[model samples]
Target: MRFFEYQDRARRRLTLLLGLFALVVVLMVALLNILLLYTLVEPWQELRRLMPTAEMLAEHRGFLLWTTGLAIAVIAGASLGRLYQLRRSGGGRGIAREMGGDPVDAEPEDPKNRRLRNIVEEMAIASGLPVPAIFVLERELGINAFAAGFTPHDAAIAVTRGAIESLNRQELKAVVAHEFGHIRAGDMRLNTQLVGILFGIEMIALLGLGMLPGRRARSDPGEMRGPVWFNFALVAAGGIGLIGGRLIRAAIAREQEYRADAHAVQFTRNGDGMAGALRKVAARYAGLNASPAMVGHMLFANGAIDQLLDTHPPLEKRLERLGQPLDEEGLERLGREATDRVRRAVTERERRRREQEAAAEQRREEEENGPLGEAFGAVPGSLAAALLAALPGELARSARNPHWVADLVLYLILHPDPEIREQQLHMILETRGPESEERVRQLRAMVPEPAAEHRLPLTEMAFPALARLSRDEQRTLAGLVERLIHADGRLSATEYALGRMLIEHLDRRHGHGGKTTHGRKDPAGKNARHRENAARYLLATLALHGHPDDLEAAEAALIAGLGRFTGSLPFSAPIPEELRQASQSAAWARILDRALERLARMPRHDRQRLLQAMDDTVQQRGDPTAEQRELVRMMAASLHLNVPLPDAGELFDAGH
Candidate 1:
C-alpha cells in the first residue's frame, strides 16, 4: 500500500479499537450494577430473578440509578481526566520525562549520544521532517525504544541505554528507523491516545485496591463486613475490565509492530540489520522495569512478561516475516558476533577520543590565527560540516547556544537600511527591554553582515535551542519577529520567508495548528479550485523573483514552470499585465504565504509536482541568484518537502 493509505488504515483500526474499549467500559458498568443488586438488595435468594419485576424495580429504582450513575461517572471522568493530563504535560516530552529520560544535548560530548543524534538528524533531513527532540532513558537497560507525540512537530524519541551499548551501528540505525516509521505512519498520536484511555480502565482497579481495609484498621467488624464485600466486588469487576483493555490493546499493537518492521526494512533497504537486532533482543532479553502497561504498546519491543497480552509479535514470527528466521544455532552465532561488534565499537570510540584530544591543540591554534573559511575547510567533508563552514563561526556558535539564539534571530530580522534598522532596534529595546536589545546589538557587531545563504542554515541550526524555550517566550519572540519584518514599511521576500519558517516551526512544536493532510481525502472536489490557484500563484511568485529586471524572461520562466503541472492541474501562464500587477502589489507576501500554506495540505504526489515546478522556475535562466535559491529553499520548507539542501561546496559555487 501507499504511505497515506497505510496511515488511513491505521486510523480506521484505531477507531474500531476505541469502540471495543467503549464496549469493555459498558460491560464493567453492567457488572457493577448486577453486583450491587445481588449483594446489597436481594442476596443469592433473588439472584435467579436478577431482572426485577415492575413492583420490585419501582421499590429499588433510586438505588439502581445511583449505582449505575456512579459507575459511568467514575469511568468517564477518569478517562477524560487522564486525557487532559497528557495534553497539559506537553505530549512526547512529558512521556519521556515521566520515564526518566534526559534530553540529549544539542552537541553531545559522548560518542554514543553523538552517533544517535547524527542518525536522527540524517533521517529527519532525508524525510523532510523537523528534527524531533531526542532523549535517552539512562536507567533503562532493555533493547527497546519508542516515539511519542501528537504530531511530528512535538514528537520525541527515547532509546534505552542497552540498545545504544549493545547494538552495532547498522543495528541501531535499523532500530531508529523502526521508530521513525511509527512517526511517519501517524502512530504516535494513536499510541498516546491509547495510553490515556487505557489508564482510565486501570484506574478502576487502583480505586478498588485503595478502598480495601488495611491490616491496621480499627473499625467495628460488623460495620466493616458490608464495605469489605463491596470492595471485593469492585476489585473483581475492575480486574476483568483491565484484562479486556490489555487484550484489545495487544490485538491492535501486534499488527502495528508488523507494519513498522516492514517500514524499517523499506526505509533502510537492509533487512538483515533489522533481523539482526531482533535476534540480539531474543538472545539477551532484559525488559524495561518501568510502567510497562502504560507504554508497552509504544515500545519497539514488548517490555513486559505477559505472554497472552504481549504488545509485540513473537521474535520468531517477526523474523519469519522478514524472511530471515533463524534456528537456535544461528541465533547463538549471531549473539557471538554481536558481542564482538560491541567490543570493537568500544575500542574504536576510545581511539577516536584519544585522537580528538591530540588534535584539540592544533584546532585551537588554527582558530587563533586562520580565517574562519580556512578553519572550516580543514574540517572533514559532510553535509553538516559544509553547512557549518558556510556560516560565520560566531553566528553559527550563537545559533547553537540556547541563551544567545533569540538574539541571533533578531539580528537576522534587523532591516538593512540604517534608519529602518534603528527604528526596529528601538522597538526591540522598548518591548524586550534594554538587556535584550543589548544582546541583539552585540550579535550584529559580531557578524557585521550575514550573507544571504546563511539564513536557511542558521535558522535550521537554531531549532533545537528554540525548542527549549517556554511557550510564552516563543510567542513573544514570534511577535517581535513580525514587528521587525514590517518595520521597513514593505515586506521583502527574505523577511516573509524567514518569518514563515520561524512561525510554522513553533506552531507544530506546540501542537496549535490545524490538521495535517496525512490521511485527508478531497474526493468532493471542494479544494480543487483553491489548490489550482495556489499552484498558479506560487509559480508566478517564484518566476517574478527569479527574473526581477526582465519581464520577458520572467514570463518565459513562469510558462516553463506552469508547463510541469499542465496534465494534472489546470495551470496557464499569466499575462504581462497580471505579472506587473503582482510585482507592484503590497499583498504579494500575504498572498504567497496563504498559497504555500494551502499547498502544504496537498497530497504527496501533488506536492512533489509542485516542488518540481518551483525548482524548474528557479533554474530556468542559467544560474539562480542567491535570493532565488533562498526563496526555493524557503518554499520547500514551507511545503514540508523532504528535499535536502546543497552542501557547503555547492553553496560556495553558487556565488553566495
Candidate 2:
C-alpha cells in the first residue's frame, strides 16, 4: 500500500490547507481593519463639528495598523485555542464522542452488536492490525461509518444506528472494510488533524455570535451606533472565514473518500457489499442534527455540510466508480430493492454468520494451516476467518471476554523446559493467585504443540482483550510476560516477537508513545560504511539466534547472508571476533531492536535490499528451516514490515 507515499501526500495536503487558511485569516484581518477605520472615522467627524477641521487625524494610520494586527491576533488565537481543546480529547475517542457515538464492548450485549464486533475483528485480523475500538452513533439514522485515530493502534470505528439496522452481514463487512482502508492508509490521522486544525479557523463564527447580544443595546437612545456596525462586521468576517474553512475541508475530504471506497473493494475483493451500502446512503441522505460542524468532513457521508461544501463525492459518482453506476431513478430503485433485500436477509444473514462461525469453531486446524504468505498485509478474508476459527474455544472466548484475556497471553509465555516452567509457574502463582493459575494450566494443556506459529496468531487475537485492560492491569500484565520470558534465562526469538507485539499494540492504547516510522529518514547510504556495519550486526544477530548451539553454523549463516550484498560494499570489513562476542550478550536484544528500526526507516528500495539479503541468508541451505522462517517473521514484525509469512511449501523441500 506504500504507507510512506500515502503519508507524504496527506502531509502535503495539510500543508496546502493550512496555507490557504492563513490567506483567508489575512483577508479577514484586512476586512476587520477597514471596518474599524470606518467606525473610528464616524466619531472623528463628530469631533470635527466641535473643532472646525481638527487636522485630519494622521495617527489614524497607526491605529489602522494596530487594529489590523489586533484582528489577526484575535482570529489566530481563537482558532488555535479551539484546536488545543479538541486535541486534548484524544484522537478517535474524541471524534466519536463529538459525533454522539457510544463506545461498544468487545462482547456487546445485543445480538446485532455482536455481529458488528465480529466484522470489525475479521477486518483487523485480515490486515494484521490491532482491533480498533468500536462505537455506534445511536441517534443518527444515516447509513454511515467513519474511522478516527492517529494510527491503527489507537483507531476507533463508528457506525450510525441506521447502518446497523439496515446493512446485511456482507454489506456491513464492506462498510467496515472501507473504514479499515482509511485506518490502514493513514487517512484517519489526517482526518483527525483536519478536524482539530479547522476548528480554529471556524471559531471566527463563534466569535461573531458572541458579539450579537450587545447590538440591541446600541439601538437605545444613549448608546453609540459604532458598536452595532462592529458586531455586523464581526459576523461578516466570521462567516467568510467559516466558508473558506469548509471549502478546504470539503476538497481534502472528497478525494480521500473516493480512495477509501476503492480500497474497500480491493480489501474485500468484491464490490457488491460496498455498492449496496452506498446505494442505501444515497437513498437516505438524512443525518443527525447533533453532528458537530468540526466532524462533518470525517463522516462516511456528508453529515450536515452545506450543499456547496459536501465532503463526500456525489452518491452517483461513488457508486459508478465502484462498478455499480446508477442514475437518479436507478439509485432510488436500487435503494428500495436493497432495503427490502436487507430486511428479508437479516434473519438469513444472522443464520449464515452463525453457521460460518460455528464451522470455524469446528475446524480449528485449518486456521493454523494457512500459507505463511498470508501473514503480511491485505490478508485474504478466507484466511482471516480460518485463523479466527483455528483459535481454541476457550482462548477464543477469552479473546472476546476482556476480563480473562491477560491470562491467555501469560499462558503463551510459559516455558517448555521443566525448570524454567517451574520458575514461571511459581511467579504466576505468587503474583496472580489460583484463578490465574487455573486459567494458565487449562490453556497449557489445550494450546497446540511447539506453539511457534500459533503464538503470534493467538497473540493477535488477544489484542482486543489486552486493549481492554485497566492501566494497572496493563502494567502488571506486561511485567508478568517479561518475567516469564526472562525466567528461561535466555531470550528466544519467539519470546522477543511476543514481547514486541504486546508493547507495540498495548502501549499505544495506554497513552505510551506508539509512533510508527512513516516520516523517518532513509539514512541508509548517507553513511555507507556505518550502514553496512549495521546490516552485518543485524545478520549476525539473526544468524546466532538461528543457529544458537553451533557457533560455526551461526558464522556460516552470517557469511551466506553477507554474500548477497557482496557487490554493494566491497570496502566494508567483516565483524570482528570482539564484536561477535558483544553481539551474543543480552544487550544484543537492544542492538537488534535498533537495527530493525533503522532498516525499517530506510527508503522502500533499501528496505527491500535488506530483506532480500536476510532471505538469502535464511534459505542458504536450499531448505527453509523452522528457525529460519521464524527469524524472518520476527525481523518483519520488528521493522513493522507486513511481509506475508514466507510460502512454506515453495521455500522448503519435503521432510527437510
Candidate 3:
C-alpha cells in the first residue's frame, strides 16, 4: 500500500479531529457565557437579555469575556495534564499494563507463546522494523490484538489467549500483520493523542457528576435555585463533550480499521486468513475485557460497546470484502483448517528439531548460500528466516538473556585494528569500570565472530534485551558504546550503521527525541534545484567512497547515479568541494543525514530509483568488495531500508 499517502491522510484526519476539539471548546464557552449571564442578571434583566431582539447582547460583554477565559483554561489545563500523564506512562506500555497483560517471553519456550513470537518476529523483519515486545492476556477469552507505541522500536503487540488458542498459524499471522500495519502507518501515535483529547473532555463530564450531589443541599430555597441552575449548566456542557468525543472516535476509528485491513492483505498476500479470523470472531460472539472501554479503538475488534461505540466494521461486511461469504460449508472448513494447521505446525517443528540435531553444519551452509529474497520493501519470509538462522548461537543466546546483553553489545563495538582495539578497551575501562570491562573482554574472546552480512540481524536480536535496561541505564550504555565506536578515530560503515541503529532504538524506547512518523523529507523537495542538489550530494559521496583510487571512475559513477533522477546533467559531475575539504572530519555523517532525509521525502518510486542508482555505482567494479557491500548496506540502513546484502539485484529487479 502507498505508505506516504496513508500517512498524509492520517495527518489530515488528525487535523480534522483537533479542529473538532476546538469547536467543542468554543461551544462550551458559549454555553457557560449564557448560563453565567443569566445567573448574574436580575430576573427582569435576565428576561430582557434572553430576548431574541437583543441581537448583539452588548450588555453581557463582561460575562462573555469571563466565561470564555474560564472555559479555555479548564479545557486547556485538563487536556495538557492528561497528555502529560499519558506521556509519563511510556506510551503503549502503560496502556497494556493497565489492561492486566503479562509480558510474554522475548524468545518464548512455551509452544503456544513461541508460535506467536515467531509470527510477530517474521512480520517485524519482513517490514524492516524492530521486533516489538509481546504481551498476552491469558485470562481473556476473546480474540483480539493491538499494536501500540510512538514508534516501531518501542511498540508493543498484545493478544488475548483466545486468539492464540483459536487461530492457526496463517490466521494469526494475518492478525499480527494488521497490527504491524498500524505501526507502519503511524496510527498508534494518533490514537494516543485522541485518547488524551477525549480524556480532557471526560474530565468535564466528571466534574459535572461531582457537582450533582450538592445541588439540593442549600438551606435557602432561593440559593438552591442558583446551585440547581449552575449544576444543570455543568451537566449540559459535560454532556455535549461526552457525546461529541464518542462520535469523533467512531468516525476516525472506523476508517482507520478498514485501511489497516487492506494493509494486512497487501502485506501477507492472504485474504482468506484475515477473513477467516474475522469470521471466527463473529461466530464466537466474543468481546475483549483485556483493556478498558477507552482503548476500544486500538483493538483488532471492538472491546466493550461494540454497537454504540463500535471501532470496527461489521464482520459480515469484512468477510464480503475479502470475497469469503458466510456459507455454512465455509464456516465448517475454517474450523477444520484451524485444527489441522495447528497439528501440522507441531509436526513440522518436531521434524525440524530432529534434522537440526543431526546436520546442523550442513543446514547452516545451505541457509547461507540460498537466495536472499526481496531487499528493498517487505522481505520474503524465507529470506527473513535465513537471516535469523545466520545469527551466531552465542549471540542469539545472549540476546535472550537480559543479564548478558550489555556485555555482548559492548563486545560487538570492539574495533578490529589492534591499536584501536586497545584504545576502545581503555575507554570502556575508564567509563564502565574494571569489572564490567573485563566481562565484555572475556566474552569477546569466547564468541565466534559474525560476518559482515550478519551485523544487522545480530543487532535486531539484541533489541529485546537492550529494552530490558532502565531508561537511565540505557542512556549510560548508549554513551559508552558511542565512545568505543569513535575511539578508533575513524568510523567504518558497519560501525556507523550499528551505532545509528543502537541509539535510534534505545532513545525511542526511553522517550528521547526521535521522529514519530517515518517521512523526514522537506516539502521543498518539489523544487527541481533542491532535488538535484540532494541527488548530487548523495551520489558524490557514494561515488567518491566506492572508487577511492580513481578520480575519473568516481566522476563516472556520480554521473551514472544522477542520471536516474529528473533533468539531464553533464556526462561527469565533479565531487562537491565540501566532500574533499571535510574528508578528514566526521562531517560526512551529518551531511549524509541531511541529504538522505530530504531524499527520503520523495515518492516511493523515486526513492527506489535512487536506491537502484546507488546499487549501480557500487557494482561498477564487477562484484562489490566486502567494504563496498558494507558501505551500501549502511547507506540503505541509514535511509531506513534494511536490505539483505546478496539480494540487491532481485530487490531492484522485482520493482518493489
The runs of at least 3 residues in candidate 1 whose Cα sits more than 4 Å from the true structure, single-residue gaps closed, are: 1-15, 30-46, 49-70, 84-102, 138-142, 148-151, 205-237, 262-272, 291-294, 337-399, 407-461, 470-476, 492-498, 507-656
lDDT of 3: 0.67
> Model 3 Cα RMSD, Å?
7.6
What value does the lDDT take at residue 466 in candidate 1? 87
lDDT per residue as tens, model 2, 421-528: 878888999988987887777667766343364566566667756766788888877778877877755676667767766765566666663333544665563576
Assess candidate 2 and give its lDDT: 0.64
Clashing pairs in 2: 79-200, 372-645, 376-644
- By lDDT, who's the top model here? 1
Give the range where candidate 2 is weakest over 10 consecutive residues by summed lDDT. 369-378
Score candidate 1 by TM-score against the native: 0.67
Cα lDDT of model 3 by residue, 1-656, tens digit: 34234444655675686678667766766766666566555353545655323543576666678767776677678877876876676666666777777787544445678778767766665455667778887666667888877666677888887788788777888899888777766677777777776676667667666776453565566656765666667677767876777777776776677667766665565677898788777655356754564456768986445465777777776677677776655666665655555456556645765866646556445433232221112234455555655556566656545666777778777887788878887887887788768767766665545576556555666787788888887898899888787775566545765787787767767656354124654678767688778878877777877776778888888887777664455666888776665435656666666676677677656766777777777666567665566556556655555443243333322112
Instruction: Tell me the number of clashing residue pairs for each predicted model.
Output: 1, 3, 0
Please report how far candidate 1 places residue 527 from its true position, in Å.
10
Error of 1 at 449 (Å): 10
Error of 3 at 77 (Å): 1.6
Every candidate's lDDT: 0.71, 0.64, 0.67
- The TM-scores, one per candidate, come to 0.67, 0.72, 0.74
lDDT, candidate 2, at 384: 55
Model 3: which ten-residue window has the lowest total lDDT?
Answer: 369-378
